[model samples]
Every structure is written in C-alpha cells, then in structure tokens.
Target: METRIRSEARSYLFVPGNRPERFAKALLAGADAVIVDLEDAVAPHDKDRAREAVLRALPELASVYVRINAADTCWFDEDVGAFAAHPAVQGLVVPKAANTEALAHIDSRSHARLALLPLIESAAAFTALDAICHAPRVERLLFGTVDFQLDTGFGGDGEELSYFRSQMTLASRLANIGSPVDGVTMALDDAGEIFDAARRAQRFGFGGKLCIHPKQIAPTHDAFTPTEADLAWATRVLRAAQGSAGSATVVDGKLIDVPVIERARMILARAR
Candidate 1:
C-alpha cells in the first residue's frame, strides 16, 4: 500500500470522538478531512467510550484523521491498538509528539498505509523537529499554536510564532514530507479573521489550516485559493514573459526574473 498525504487539503475539521453521530456530519461539512479528536476534546472519564466510537466510525468516515492521546498517557496505547486492525483511518494525529519512540510504537501497531501527523506544540518537540519529521510513517507536522502559547508563555500569535512556523516549513521540506499544517484560528464565526490567519500561514509556507468549526472551512479554502486579482496579474506576467523569450523584462515597473515568473506560474496553476 502506498502511504500518501492529502496535498490538496486546505481545511481539516475537528469533531469530538465520543460523538459518533457527528462523525458523518463532519465529513459532510465540506472539510477536505475530518479529525476525530480523542485528546483535549474528550474528557478523561469518557476516554474509553470515545475510543470505541472513533474506531467504529473510521470505516464510515473515509477521510477521517484520528487524534490520539499522547504516548505518555494510558489511553495512548489502546488508541493505536484499536485502530491498528481497522486500517480505514486515513491518518493518525499525535499531539505533542516529541520523540521517535512513540511514533515507532504506533507504527508497529498500524498498517503501512497509515500516515502520521505529529502535532508539534512543546518546546521539546521544537528541538526534536528533525527526528519527528523523519520518524517512520510521518507524513507531516501540525503546529499547535494555542497549546504552544501556553507551553512557551508567548502572548502574541503574529510575529512571535513565525519562528516556529518557519522551522516547521523548513524541517518538513528537508524531511521530504508534505508541507506542515498551521494552527487554528480561535475566532469561529469571523471569516475575515480566519482568512487572514490562514493567508499568513500560507505565506509562511504552510499547506493547510486546522478548522475548529464547520464555518471556518470555506474561509480557509478561500484563503489558499488564488483570487481573481492574482489570476489577472499572473496572466499579464505570463504574456509579457512569453514574448521576451526568457530575457529580463519589466512588468508593472518590476523586473520579471525567473523566480518572479515561477511565482506567476504557481498562481496560474492554483487557479486551474
């Protein structure tokens, strides 16, 4: 089986694992993938029930990604074991993944086709980015902004987090994995805020944004999609460069170099 990541995914919606009824609804919510969160979202008392619900829903939720509890926790072992035989899960999202040991453990339980997405949040995880990205079955890393802020005592989310975001991008590219996914936008109903946050992450080289609610999926996808203005500019640049025959040409007072032309081509490609 070929272990692959969903490169075209722009939005990932989270649904609590205990709610099996909402599992189907989440897939229908228009997200590229639905994540059944067993950590943070599920209470300690309901861990067993949530795990049971998630395992049962996997076959029905084709694109579902399960967020299992950390390896240090008791439920972690059981979470991976339950999903091991199912193989219907597209991916497993491990929160606060800081070492290779846990990844190896989960890899031993699951089939070869299951992709691993480590949610890098702790300072220790940051230092161990290379190991985590290179771990067996690791498809990509997901930035946990809210938890990271709490972990690192960082207050601002804009510039303060760029360093971590850049590290995620660089490490993933070097590891030859899919682009890292950015953290979620807390403002659920505000499309403007969600779009801005996702656009910033995309500029930082992220390929996807985490969605806390269904309303955020559309705004997140729109942020990653090329706009009409971008398409128009790319078209103009392509036309000018076509006649220039690779020679340095000026378009809108800017020299159209190889890198500039490449960006234009990317925009046009995304438009298609």
Candidate 2:
C-alpha cells in the first residue's frame, strides 16, 4: 500500500481496542484519525481480548490507526506479530520509542508500508530526538505529556514540560517531517480545560492535539483550524511578498518571512 504522512489538521481520537462498540462510532465521530489503543487503555486482563477485537474490527475501518504496546513489554512482540499481516492498519503509533534501533526492528519485520509516529515520552527519547527522526520509517513525533510529566517528576499542570515539547517540535521541523503532535488532555468531562490545554499546545507550534474521548474532537479541531481573519491576513502577506526581492517583507505593519509565508500557505491549504 502507498503510505502518506498525516498532513491535515489532526484531532486524533483514541478508542480502547477492547471496546468494539466504540470503534465504529469513533470512525464516524469526525476525527482526522482514530487511534485504537491497546496500550494504556487496556487493562492487563483485557489485553488479549482487546487485541482480538481490534483484529476483528480492522476490516471495517476506513481511516484510523492502531497504537500497540511498547516493544519492551511482554505483549509488544505479540502485538506486532499479530498485526503484521493486517493490511488495513494505516500506521503504528509506537509508544516510548527511545531509539532508532527499535523502529528499525519493527519496520524490518512488518510487511505493511506502515508509517511510524514515535512517542517521545522519556528523557532518553527526547535526548535522542535527532537519531530517532532520522530513522527511515519515522513519519512524525508525538509528545506524550502525561508520561513525560511523570518521567520528569513534574506536578500539577505541565508548565515544567514546555522545554521538552519545544525541543520535540524543533527536531521534527529540522528533520523535514510533519508538525509535531501534542499529547492528550486527560480531562474528558471538562470542555473548558480541554480547550485551554489544546490552545496552549497550538501556541507552542503543535499541529494537533490527541483526544481520549470523542467529545473532545470537535473542540480540538475548532481550536486548530485557522480562522477567517487568519486566512485573510496570510493572503495579504503573500501578496505583499509577490513584488519583493528580499527574503522578508512587511505585511500589516509587521515583518513577514519564509516561515510566515509557509505558515500562511498551510492555513490556506487547510481552509481549502
């Protein structure tokens, strides 16, 4: 199968693999992509059941992903081995991907032309961001906020994790991949908290936010999509640059350059 990286505005929703009833609903829930999670979402006793359910439901899925457990765990080998033959699985969101060796091993074994989105949770992974992104199979980097917070011993909100988040985003850009994805906001019932956290992620240059519940999808998408005002401004900026010779130009009394132009084009493309 031909593989493509996730380019559109992303609001990936995670559904527990054992919950087959929620699988169909998640696909129809208007998320950019659905992540059938067998890792954190599944209890120890339910791992086998979740795997079977996900395999059974794969044939019916239109656009979604399967997040298997970490490769270091007892279930990791089984998880990858079981799904190796499934063609419908679009990509693998590998959790706690500490190095390129793990990614190489997974890619070498899988038959599917599966893209990899490595989860950068540990300090080791963060420190090795360059080598990880250079891995031929990696397509994007996903920041695992909660795991990161725990790994770093940060308490309360995730203010302490900003440096790591910024570093991952920069690494992804330098590696010439799609924008980095922000981790999920775990407060499922509170829309206000979800929006605030997602917005903060956006400000930090995250292209998307992961969602644990379907209810968070719409709000996350809305927060990520560019507004009409933003589009209009981008258009004016580009028009101003049309007659300029230098690398930078003035737009709306502000300086604009290649980065600004690129961001403007991204907004307009998504708006289209």
Candidate 3:
C-alpha cells in the first residue's frame, strides 16, 4: 500500500545537519516542518561528521525530517541505517531521487514508520515522476528548483520553470499525494519577494515552500493562507452549491460545477 500523504505543512525550513546548534532554533521558528539537511548543505569533508552529529542529536529533536545524501552517494546507506528508524525522524527527504528502486531501498532500510519526501531535481526524475510518486513509503514530492535549473540549463526561475512546476503538481495530483513543495526563494530578508514567490508557487498548485532561513516561514504561511475575500467567496460558493442538490448552479455570474465547488472547498480548507 502507498503511504498516507496527510501532512498539511506549508513551510519546510532547512537547517544544516552539521550545525546542530541551530536545530532547536529552527524548530522553534514555527516552520510547519524542519528538515535537517545532510545533502547539498553539508560540504564533502563534513558529510560523515554531519551525519554523526545529526544521528546523535535525533533523540533531542522532535518530529524532524532529514535530507539524506542521494541514493547513489557512498554515504547513503550509512545515513539510512543511522536515522531511518529513529523515532525522532518524522520522514526522510531523499535528494536527487529519480526512480522507484532507490525509494524501495530506503524503505527497506527503515524499521520505523516514516514518510519519504522525494526531491524532483533532474530531467531523469521528471521522466520517472509517476514511478517515484508510487514508490514505497513515498508521501510527498519536493521540487528542487535550483538543482533542476542547473541540470537542465534553465536560464531563469520564472517562465523557464513554470511548465516544470506544473508537471510536478500534476504528477503529485495523479499520484494522490500532497501537492509538491516549491523550491526556496534566495532572498533572506525581503519579505515581499518571498511572499510573492510563494504566492506564485501557490498559484501553480504547490502546497508549501522550502525555506533556507527562518524569516521566510511567516511570509510563506501568509502567501498560502486564504484571504478574507477568498474565504467569503468560498463561503458563497459552498452555500450556493449546497442548494443545487448535485446540479450545476450559478454563483457570481459564473456557472458553479463540481470542479468549482471542489476548488471552493479547497480554499476554505486552506483558510481553516
């Protein structure tokens, strides 16, 4: 059976694994989830040490996820064996994930119940999107926009990435998983930029965003939250749809059908 994808987290803050000192601070920063990164964030020389530090600190952490090195890396097996079954680990963020075999391998190593958040970062990953989504223990897909750009030679994050973003969202929807998480915005202190980027991601059907800093959390949440006008419209849509008794209805001069009603309910769900 596929793992249940029920996480409603809208902000995932990444803390470098080697920097154990920042673990508590990231958790308390109010991100819906904290990712203890052991992949790109950690330098090659520090890989072993970072894994050691993260494993040692797992008991002190609460419901945290770990971004382990890619399945092809020499360190992958050790990282899996060390933390996959640890109670403190809520999930494992598998970076550069492209196939079901890799996900199955990770699942096999774990003795504890855990979700797998696969990073869709390469063209290869896009080709195998469905396979990755339906892989064992997989729960959510995360768009690694930066790496994807690098891998594909995409020139910019805007139009160049729109189609890719849509593909990720569409694949997740087809797999019945939570909407994929968007990549991080580079701005650390610009709330407006962060909020705009997040809003764009939301429009593209992403449920959350990756954060490199704690400051991005609040703005990310603000972007995902339904506005007053949105809530009111959703309420109106729901009320009107309720009286239709399975028939299409009219609301605000537009036809309200099953899809529109579902959209309204989704807006209200996000608001709540």
Candidate 4:
C-alpha cells in the first residue's frame, strides 16, 4: 500500500477545474489541500473543456485532488480516463460514491498512484460505507452535506444531520482510515458560523472540513489546528501522565484519561 498522505491542517478548498485563474490562487491561499472540482462546478457542455484545463494545470499544484463525478454519470468514464493519464494527479475525490464497486473500478483503471477520497452523500452510500472504505484505493471518507440534505430531505441546521455526520466519522475510524472530513459550511461571508461549524465537527471526530471559498479556509484551518493554549495544556497533561497508568490523570485540577490523552496526542501531532 502507498503511504497515506497526512494533512497537517484540516481545511480543503474547492476550486473549479474550468477556472484556471483560481487554481494557482487556491494553492497559495494556504488551504491544506486544493480539490480541483470537475463535477458540479463545471457545466455539462464544458466537461471536456474542464478536463483539458485540469490536465494542463495539474503539474502546477503543490498538493491537490480532483473531484470527479459519480460512477454512474455520463462523464464518469472520461473523468477517470483523464485522471489516469495525468501523472501529476495525486488523489481523486469521487462524489456520491455508492459502494465498493465504484471504487474498485477506479482502482483497477487508475495508472497514476492516486488516493481515493469518497464523498458519501446518500443514505445507500452511508449504509455501504463499511464495504466502500475497504476498497484498496480509498484513503479518506468525505461527507457531502448539501447533496446529502437534498437526498435525505434533512434540514441544514447542524443538529438535523448530526447523526449522519457522526456515522461517517465512526465508520472511518473503524476502517482505520484517516479522519473523516465534515461537509462544507455554505455560509461564505459568515466567519463566525464557519468557525462554529468546523469546531463542532472537530468535536465529533472529524479531522477536517471541506470549504467552498478561500475566506472559509483560514477559519476552518484555525478551528482544526491546536491553538497555543491547547498545545500547552496538552503538553502539560502528557507530562503529568508520563509515569502514570490507569483510567485518569488530573491536569490543572481537571481529570484526564485515555480519551483525553488521545485527543491531546492528536493536537500535538497536528501542531507538529
């Protein structure tokens, strides 16, 4: 197996593959990774054009992935074909991935050593997550909140879709994969709302968030990365528990245990 690509911060910015101008800008915008979206963002008639543009730009990206249409889409085969031919492509984000078979096809066809980030958007896909993640190419699970809400008739409020989001995270953990990505916060201008949403997702074991706009990237990264205070507290807790074992350790009058230690280590790792 290829070594997993670990993201230091948890903000992924989406840029339209058709818009060549935004490609370099997104990479420079400090997002942990840039997802060059060829599906949804591109018009049906422009799919071929967008594919060409993306192929031309792939060589310029530092860390990037392509979001292809689902396997059943008319353009799915073309999307995979284009990616397979591009040696610069590092990863692929398959939207609305329904099962392992779709991923298996991608694995069998891809010539480029690309990791798979499956976007779980439908109820059926959620149910099939266990089998889906077991696919050889799958690296991370990404929740597609907007499409999911549309498919399930769920509301946008965080509470309404909490269960689904949690299920995705739990499934990723069970599969021993990288942390699941929370869906994007659609409020582009509301930094406060974006921050709150990212933090909430973090609490739910989501290691990262998908972002639509460049403005949302900074706040999302901030929300996921450990703050100075957080790092200090974590360092202190680890030191206090250096020679200790058992269920808990008291740090600054607060009790800490395995769960707390695990969280602290995650914070420290992100810090590094």
TM-score for each predicted model, relative to the true structure: 0.94, 0.89, 0.94, 0.91
Per-residue accuracy of model 2 over 1-272 as CA lDDT, tens digit each:
22335455478888998899999899889888888999999998999989999888888984467898998888888888777546787778899988887788778777556777889888789779998877866778888878877887778446777787788778877877777889988788888888888877888788898888888987887788778899899889778878686657788889998888888888898777
Model 4 spans > 4 angstroms off: 1-9, 243-249, 255-259
Residue 46's lDDT in candidate 4? 95
Q: Cα deviation of 56 in candidate 2 (Å)? A: 1.1
**What is the full ranking by TM-score, best candidate first?**
3, 1, 4, 2
lDDT of 2 at 37: 95
* Candidate 2 collision pairs: none
Candidate 1 residue-wise lDDT at 231? 94
Model 3 regions more than 4 Å off: 1-3, 243-248
- Which stretches of model 1 miss by more than 4 angstroms? 1-6
Tens-digit lDDT string for candidate 4 (6-99): 4444988899989999898988888888899999899999988998898888778745789998788899998888885466777889998888
Q: In model 3, how large is the Cα lDDT of residue 161?
A: 95
Candidate 1 displacement at residue 96 in angstroms: 1.1
Best by lDDT: 3
Query: Which candidate's TM-score is highest?
Result: 3
